[model samples]
Target chain A: MGLLSLLSGLCRWNNNDEENSAARSFILSSVLWLAFVVSLALILATKFVWPDFLGGTAWLSFGRLRPLHVNGALFGWLSMSSTGIMLYILPRLTGVRLYSERLGNLTCLLWNLLLIGASITLPLGYTQGREYAEFILPLDYLFMSILALLGYNVFKTVARMKDKAMYVSLWYFLGSLVWMPFTYMVGNNFLMDTTGLGGRGPVPGVNDAMLNWWYGHNIIGMWFSTLGLGIFYYFLPVLTKNPLYSHRLSLIGFWTLAFFYVWNGQHHLIYGPGPDWLEDVAITFSVLMLIPVFAVVYNFFKTAQGSWHLMFDNSPEHLPVRFFMIGGLAYFLTCTQGPFQALKAVNSNLHLSYWVVAHAHLAFLATFSFISMASIYYVLPRLLNTSINLRLAHWHFWLLCLGLIIFLGILHTAGIVQGAMWLVKLEEYDFVTGSALFKPAVEFIDIVRLLHPFYFTLWLGAGLMATGVMLFVVNVLLTFYKADSPGGRLRSKGA
Target chain B: MYTALILFILAGSIICLGGIYYKRSIVLGILVPGAMLLIIIAFLSTAVLPYMEKIPATDKGVPYSERALLGRQIYVREGCWYCHTQQVRPIRTDAGLGNVSQPGDYQYDYPHVLGTERTGPDLSHLGGKYEDDWHRNHLMNPRPKTPEEEGMAGKVKGSVMPPFSYLSREETEALVTYLQSLR
Candidate 1:
C-alpha cells in the first residue's frame, strides 16, 4: 500500500493550496466523468449495438466488458464522485482545511491509474475472475494505498475540526471509508492462499459463493447503506427544514444496522449450503432488518414532513433528496420482503429467479441512487464553484427512478418465467438441449422474446439518464468559477 | 391504491414523528411501528390466504404420504426464498420453471412460501424431476447441466449460476428429499 502511494504521488498534480483546492476537485471530478462516459459508451455499445472495440475478439467478449462496465460505474463514476464530494464536504462540515492536498492528490491519481490498468488487463484477459475484485495483483497495491490515504486524511480532518460534536453524517462518511477497505480485504479471499494468483482453471464454486455473498451483501450493508444514510442524515433535514427527529433513534439505527445487518447476510444463501442455523438466524435477522431501514426512513420522512413545501419550491433539495427519501421507503419494502423470501417455504420456489435480481437492483441501483444523486446535488455546486442546472438535475432524478423500476420490471418477469417453468415442468417449453457452451435464446427464451420491447424501454430510459448526466457535467462546467473560499477551505488555515 | 397506502404511511409517520423534529421532543413514536406492523400484516395475509395444497411426493416404490410434508418445513427454515421462489405470475416468459404452482398446491402450509425473486426458480411442483445424480450436479453448478437436462440454462443463451458445492452430502440429500416432496 505504501509503495503504491509513492508511485501515485509521482503523477498527481498538486493543487491543494487554499486557492486551488476546489480547482483540484473540479479537475478530478472531470477525470472521473470522462472515464464514466467512456465506460458507459462501451457498455451501451454492447447492450444496444456492438462497437468496433469488441470486434472479432474472444478476449474482448461481453464477459470481460461486463466487468469493465460494472467497475466503471462503481469505481469510476461512483467512487470518483465520492472523492469530489468528500473534498468539498470535509472542510465545510468540519470547519477545517483538508489535512493534506498531497495525500488527496495521491488517492485520486492511484484510483484513476488503477482504472487505466484495469481497462487494459480486463480486455487482455488478466482477470482474477472475482466479481468486483477482478483486478490483477499488481494493480491491487494501488487500491490498498488509496484506501489508506483516504483513512489517514479523514482522521486528520476530523481531529482538527471546528465543530466539537460530530454530526451523524460525518460518522457515516468516515465509517464507510474505514469499514469498506477492511470488508474488501476479507471478502476478496485476502485470507485465502495468496499464492494462487494467475492462469487459474475454474476455482472452487463454494469459495466463490462465500466471497460473492460477502461482497454482495456488503454492497448493501456497508457501501449503499452507509453512503445512503450519510446522504439521508445530511440533506433530508435540509429539505425538510428541520433538524433530525431524534438523535437517540439515529444512534439506535446505526448500532442496529451494524450488528443485525451482519447476521442477516446469510439469508442471501437460503437455498445454498449456507448453514441451516445460520440461515434460520439470518431469517430471524432479516425480519428484524426492517427495523433499522424503517427507523432510518421514519427519522427522515418525519423530518421532511413539514418541509414538503420545500420539495416543490427547492428542486435542488427536492430532486436529489426525494430519491433518497423514496429510496428509504423502498428499502423498507425490499428488506421486509427479503425476510419473507428467506423463509424456507419461499426459498423452495424463488431461488435464482429474476425477482431476486429485481430486489437487488431496487436496493443498490434505485434506492441508493437517490442517495448518490443527493450527494451530487449537494456537493457538485461546491466542487464546480457555481449553481447546478436544476432542470437537468430534476430530469436526471426522475429518469433514474423510472429507468430502474421499468428495467427491473422487465428482468423480474423474465426471471419468474424461467423459474416457474422449471418448477411446473411445462411440456411445451421444457425440452432440454445438450451442450456445454450455451445455445443462446434457450434458458432465457422468454426474456429473449421479451427483450425486443424491454430492451427498447431500458435502452431509452438509460439513454435519457446518460443524457441527464451529460447535461449535469455541462452545467458544472457552465457554473465553474473561482469562489473566494472562506477560511475553512484547506488544512494550513486550521488547528 | 398504492398511492393511498403510501400517503397513509407518510401521513401516519408525520403525525407520530411531528413533535420530535419541530419541538426537539419525542412524541407519537408509535407511528412508525404501527405503520410497519400494518404493512407486514397486509403482506403476510396476502401470502397465507391464497395458498393451495395438492402436491404429491413419492417415497421408494410408493407415493409419498403426508409425512413427506415435513420436507417443506425444512425448506422454509433453510432460507430457500433467498434464492428460489414458488410463484409464477403471468408476464414472465423465461421457462415456466416452477412446477406450475397451483392454488391447491399449498394446502398444508402454515405460511405459503410463494417467494418474490427468481435467483433460482419456483418449486411448486418439484415433486419428482431429477435423479439424485442430476440434482447433485445441478446443485453443484447450474451452468454444467444442459438446458435439455434442467433449467433455462440450455434454453437461455447466457446465464450464470454459482454451484452450491458447500452443502454436505447429507444436507444435500435432505434438501433433495424436500425438493422431491414439493410435488
Candidate 2:
C-alpha cells in the first residue's frame, strides 16, 4: 500500500552526502535545544539566591524547574549531543555510509519530540521522582525506542563496514550502545511501583536505592563517559594528525572501564545503610578504576607528545584540540577525585556537601561537555566546508573556563566550610556552677546562613557559563548563515 | 578487602583479556550479555535478596496512608530530596541527626527518597522535631521579619530555606503529615 511504500522509502539509506548532512542537522538541532535548556536552568539557579524571585508560580518554582533542568541537560543535551556525534562518527570510522539516513532522521525527530514532552511535563510536575530517571513512564518507553533504533542503525553500519579492524572508538561505541538500554530498563523500569496496574509493587526502599545508584552511576560511567571516551579517542588522533600512541593501551582502557565501572554505583552509598560488603566492594573497584583512567590519560598525553605546542596555540584553528586537552585534564581530575571521595573518611564529610556537586559538574560539564564542544567544532567546519569565526571561538572558550573555575572553586571551599561547621564541637566551662562540661555548638541554621556568599558566587559563575554557551550558539548560527550566502568562500587550506 | 581486590582483578582480566584474545563478534556477544547478567545477579544478592528475607511487618515502617502518600508525591514533585537527605549516616558528624538509619527504616519507601545532598538538612528523624504550628509557620515563611510574626526568630535564625507559602493549605498539611510520619 501507499503507507508501506512510504515507510520503506523512509528506511532506505540515502547517498553518503545526504546521510552526512542528515547527521549534521540532527547534531546542530540537539546543540541548539541543549543550549537553550542549559541557559534557562542557569537562570533558574539565580532564584536559589533570591528564593522568592519567582516563588508564586507553580511551574516556575524551584522544585519543578530543577528536575526539568537536570533531566533536560542530561537527557536532552548531553545524551542527544552524544548520539548525534556517534551518528556522524560511526559512519566515518567504519568507512561506510549510514545504514539508514531516514531511520537516523526519524530517531532524531522522536528524540527531540520526547525532549519537548519532558520540557512541558517536568515543569508541570509530572515526574517519577527518581534522579536521572525522572521522566515519566511514557517518556521512558520513547527513550528505549530511540535507543533501540539508534543501536540498530549503529550495529548495522558496523556490520557493513568497509574497514576490517575495529577501532578502539568502535569498541567503546558498541559497548555503550549495548549497555545503555539495558541499564536504562533495569534502573527505570523493573523496580518501579506499578501498583496502579495491579503489580506486587516496588522493591524495598534500601533495594531501590541500591538499584537506583547502580543505574545512576553506570549512566555516567558506561553511557556518557564511555561515549565521550570514544569521541576523544577518535577525534584526538585526527585533530593531532598522529596515530594513537598505543592501540593496545586504548584497548586496555576500554576493557578495564567496562569491567570496573559497573561496581562503582554502591560507592555513592558508602556511609549509608547498605551492607558493609557492598560499600567495601564499591570502594575497592573505585580504586582499581584508576588503571583505565591512567591508561587513557597516558595514551592521550603520549599521542600528543610532539604536538604539545598546539595546546598553547590559541588560534581559532587550534580551538578543538585545546578544548580536548583541557577536557582530558578535567577527566583525569574527575576520575582521581572519584576514588578519593569513595574513601569512608572523605565520604563522611563530603557526601552531602557541595563537593559532590562540584565533582558532578567537573565530570559532566568540564569533561564531557568540553569534549562534545570539541567534537562539534571539528565536525562543523568539515560538515559545512567552512571555518568558524575564530574570535568568537576564543571568547567562548575563555568565558566558559573562567566561569567553571570560579563555580567549582567556590563550591569546594563552601563544602569544606560547611562540613567543618557541621562537625565543630564546643567545650563548655561552667565556671559559675563549678562544673566542666563539653557540648556541641553551632546551629545548623547558622551554617546555612554562612554559605550565602558561596551561593552568590555560584550564581555569578553559572551566569558567565550561560553567556559563554549563548555566544557559542550565535557563532555557530552565523557561520552556518555565512556558508550559505554568496561570496562566503570555504577555506581551501588545512582541516 | 582481599576478596574485593581479587574479584576486581578477575573481572578486569575477563573483559580486557577476553577482548584482546577473542574475535570481535564473540567479545561483543559475551561482554554485553555477561555484564547485564552480572549486574542483575549482584543486585539480587546484595539488595533484593536481603529485602525478601528481612522485611518486617507494620510495627516497623508501615505503609503510607492516602494523604501521606499524596504528600510524599508532592515532596517528590517539589524535588525536596535534592536538598534534604533522608538517610542519616553512622558518623560523628551525623550524631545530631537522631539515630543511624537502618535498612528497615525505609521498608515502605517506593522509589527511596534518600537524597544525595544536604543543602538543607536531614529529614529522616524530623518527626515531632517541631510542633505542627511551627512547621506551618516555617513553611509559609522560613525567615520572617518579626520574632512575633511566626515565632521563627528564636528557632531558626538566618535559615536560607525558601518559603513554601504558595502551596495550598491542603498541600501543606499533607506534606507536614508525611514529614511527621517519617519516624
Candidate 3:
C-alpha cells in the first residue's frame, strides 16, 4: 500500500482524472519551492543583521541571494501555486476536463526545471540585472514558452465548456492568461536590450527606467493580483456557502482594476527624473485605483456577512475561510497604502526606504500569499481526500499572521526613521568648499547602525513565518502519505 | 508634450469604450481586448513616447568607453546595482548625492540601471569621489579596516555591504572602473 500510494503521488499524470492530476502535481511542486525560498529569505534577513554570517562565500553573498529570494518567491512559489489553483478551478467552472493533462504535467515539470536553472545561474552571477525581471535571456524564453503552454491548456478547456455562462473567476483567470505572456515579453526579453529580440538596443536612457517600472508594477497588477483575485472570487462563495453579494460589483471591480492598474506603474518614479506630467498622470490613476480596491473589499465583506464566525472559529473546516478573511483585511490595507504612498509628498520620504519594502510585503506576502494559502487549503484536502490537522493549521495561521505583523511593523518604523534621518539637515564645516555646509543631521552610516536592532527583530519575524510555512508543508505531506492515519483522511463530497 | 499625451489618452479611451460596448462577451471578446488596449496605451505613453523625445545636448553626457562598457557588464553580472542607486532625484533625501539626474545623462546607458533601492549610498556622482586603490580595498572589505576609523572618513561605519574579495582581480578592476565611470 505504501509503495502504491507513493507511486500514485509521484506519477500524477497516470491518474484517470486529469485536472486533479495536474493540480496535485503543481501544488506539490509549489510547496517544495516555497519551503526552499522561504529558507533563502530567512538567511537574507539574518545577513542584514549580521553581514558576515556567511562570509567569503560568493554564492552566499547578499547580492546573489537577494535575486534568488525574490525570483523564487515570485515565480517558484506564488506563480506555480496560482497555476495549480487555476487548473483546479477551470475544469469545475467550465464542466470540462483540461485539454491535455499530459501537457499540464509537462508545463509543471519544465517550470520546476526553470526555477532550478535560476538557482544555479543566479548564484553563479549570471543575470540581466533587472529587478523582478531578472532571469537570464534563455530562462526568459523558457518561462514565456511554459506560460504559453499553460495558457493553451486552460484556454482550450474553456473553449470546450458545456456551461455557456462564465463565472467572474473565469473572466479573471482568462484575462491574466492573456496579459501575463505579453507583460513578461515586454518587461523581461524585449524592451531593454533588443539584441535578444533582434533590434538595435535598449529604449533610450531614462525611458528604459519608465518601461522597467511599467513592467514591474503591471506584473503584480496584471498577473499576480488577477490570478489571486480569480481564486478569491471562486473560493469566497465556496467556503462561505453563500451566493455572491453582487455580480455587477465584481464586474465593475474587474474592469476598473484593468483600466487603472497599468497607468499607475510610473508612480514608482514620483519625484525622480521622469517628466512632471508623467508623475502627475501616475498619481491621478493611483488615487483612482481606490474604486476597484473598494469594490473588491466591499464584495468580499458583504458576501462574508453571516459567515464571519467561521473566520474566528478554530475548526479545521474554517481554516480556508480564515485565510481569506485575513487576506481581505490585508488587501484593504495594502491597496489603501498603495494610493497614499504614490502621492509626491509621501513618496519623497518613503520611496527607497524600508517603508517601500514593508509595503511590498503587505501586498505580496500578507495579501496574495494568504489568498494562495486559502485556495490551497480549500483545494488540496478535496483533491487528496484527506484532512489537515486542525491544531497544526491553527498554529500555521497564527504564526504567519504574528510574524508578518512584527516584520512589517519594524520595517515601517525603521523606514520612517531612515527617511527622516536622510532629510535632517545640520550645519557643518566643509573642508572642500572652505565654508559651512548644510550636512545631514544624522549621517547615513549612523542611520544604518540605528536599524541594526530592527533588522534582527525582522529576522525573528521571518523565522516565525518560515516555521509556519514548514508546518503547512509537513501537514500537506502527511495528508498525502498518511491518509489512513488519524486526523489524516477526509471523505470530501466532491472533487 | 502635454497636448500629445492628452490626445493619445483620449483616443485610447474612446477606442476602448467603443470596443467594450460593441463586443460585450465577458471572456475573450471584451476582457482580453480591453486589457490589451490598456496595456498598449500605457506602453506607448510611458516607454515608447519617452524614447521618441529628443535628448538635449550637454557636455555632461558622454558615452561609455570600451573598458568602461566591459566594466558595466561586470558590474551588472555581480549585481552591484541591487544595493546602490545610480539615479539622484531633486528630492530632499537626495540633497547631497549629486547633480539631479537628467535623461540626457543616460543617453548611452542601455537597459538603464536606475536601481529602485539604496541599501548603500547613491553612486551617481562617485566618479572622482575616491582613488582606484580606495575602491579596490573597499570592495575587498567594505567594513572598516582599523577600529579607530568611523563613518565616511577612512572607512564607512555600520556598513552591511558584503565583501567581494572572492572576485578575481580582473573582475574587481572592471567593477571599480564601472563605479568610477558613474559620474
Query: Best by DockQ, which number?
Result: 3
lDDT of 2 by residue, A189-293 (tens): 563445342111367788878888988998998899998999999987987878889988887787778777887788999889777777887898899899999
- TM-score, predicted candidate 2 vs. hidden true structure: 0.90
Better of 1 and 2 by lDDT: 2
DockQ for model 1? 0.04
Query: What ranges in model 1 sit over 4 Å off?
Result: A1-13, A19-55, A162-164, A191-208, A314-337, A426-452, A481-495, B1-183
Pitting candidate 1 against candidate 3, the one with the higher DockQ is: 3
lDDT tens per residue, model 1, B1-183: 334434533453453344233332221132224323332332222111211212243221133344343444334333454345554433233234433233333333333354434444456556666566666666554443454644532222222333345555766676677677665
| CAPRI quality band, candidate 1 | incorrect
Interface RMSD of 3: 3.2
- Candidate 3 on A1-495: residue-level lDDT in tens? 744654455554434344477887888788888999999999899888888788678899888989999999999999999999899998889888889888888888889899999999998888777789889888998999998999899889988986666888988898898888888888874824443221114556577678778889999999999999999999989988899998877877877787778887789987777777788999998998999899899999999899988889777777898888888899999999999999889999988888988998898899988999988888877887767777888889999988988999998998898888889877667789788556556667778888889988999999999999888887776666765344443213222
Backbone clash tally for model 1?
79
- Per-residue lDDT for A45 in model 1? 37
DockQ of each: 0.04, 0.48, 0.52
Score residue B147 of candidate 2 by CA lDDT. Answer: 49
Q: Residue A181 lDDT in model 3?
A: 87
